[model samples]
Target: MESQAAFNYQQQVEEIRLAMGCDFVALALVQSEERHFQIRWEFASGNLSQRFRRIVLHSGKGVAGIVFKTGKPIFVPDAHQYYKKEDMYNYPILIAEELESFAAIPLFKYNRVKGILLAGCRKQKCMSIEKFELLQSLVTPTFGPYYSEEVTGI
Candidate 1:
């Protein structure tokens, strides 16, 4: 049986993909203690392939990993410009999904980076700054079993 939280993550990704008209939307979650907090691609929608399942991300490595380690969002208007063709291979999701533009946000829980959310497109710069901001806002403040501890307006 699928866990409710896992189910919610899938549903949320699908909803975000449709609402944003994105080519791909995925969630990377950190595994619990027995798993050593390893980050893995857990849920996704609009993906071109299942290659993400074969990938295991480390902190500060791929898009999700970087966001996970830094606790800051990463917005790449043009993946090609932002990352060299060779460097592109470093991000499994980008290569697997053939993403040309993308944005990754860190999901916080108890003030620590706990998960990652990514939205992207196959076309260059398709994920615009405005759209990126909107994406950030859409997932803001809360997610299942996780709540952003970001400091907001006074």
Candidate 2:
């Protein structure tokens, strides 16, 4: 069974998706230390399918991986313009969600990146700079069990 914390994360992701009017929003978290800290999407809203559950990522790999590895955010205002045809396969989430634009932010804990929160739009130009800034403002300092920025302690 899923824990309450996990359920709450889903609710939060949904809220963010609704607020941003985005096509998709998801949260990827690190697995236990025994699992070598692998990352997987644990919560999602407006998902196209269950494929995301099957995908596991390591640091510096996918969108979540990049944000988690660098503890910084990434904004792809235009997926078609940003990624080449050959490299499109590298971002499975984008393809899965049919996203034309997207952004990801690092979720920090104990001054380290422990999760990633991603927001995406299915239509090009739907994810504007103002929307990205709104996303950043919404999650700053802390959001649920994670921090938008790397900070010491809670």
Candidate 3:
């Protein structure tokens, strides 16, 4: 798969954020072998922190990590209710982005999970099921080199 240009990535994420009425939209990509396959938040829209650029995600460690590990999307209509206050700390993106509702989908290339697309809002129930479904649908046959037809989170 061809790598996405930074400008294109930014534009796409920004479009998604606006279309979906999300407070934040981000893409996390797996690093090359030289970087030891770490996952880092690469492109973002509506973000409040620069921490994502420096944080590397491990499999099963966080929202992006869970999606990367499971190859399925995780949608939480209410992050505050779904995750305990203390346990929510484990999900760095939620805290870092101040997300209250969110979902994540795995981006696959060659049958391997290569990236993650996450959308979120800082308000409760802001990421409705319909919206989440729309996001998933929008991703199909598009989203850089990834196709939703060939992959789904859950």
What TM-score does candidate 1 reach? 0.87
By the TM-score metric, which is better: model 1 or model 2? 2
* Span of 10 residues, lowest total lDDT, candidate 1: 141-150
In model 1, where do residues sit more than 4 Å from their true spots? 1-7, 148-154
Question: Candidate 1 lDDT, tens digit per residue, 55-134?
Answer: 89887889887988788899998988888888777888898998999988888766778888899999998999888877
Candidate 2, residue 66: the lDDT equals 86
Greater-lDDT candidate between 1 and 2:
2
Q: Using Cα atoms with residue i matched to residue i, what is each candidate's TM-score against the true structure?
A: 0.87, 0.89, 0.89
Cα TM-score of candidate 3:
0.89
lDDT by residue (tens digit), candidate 2, 101-127: 999988776688888889999998899
True-vs-predicted CA distance for residue 139, candidate 3, Å: 1.5
Clash pairs, model 3 backbone: 72-153, 73-153, 73-154, 140-148
Q: If both were scored by TM-score, which would come out higher, candidate 2 or candidate 3?
A: 2
Which is the leading candidate under TM-score? 2
- The clash number for model 1 is 0
lDDT of 1: 0.82
Cα shift from native, residue 49, model 2 (Å):
1.0
Question: How much does candidate 2 score in TM-score?
Answer: 0.89
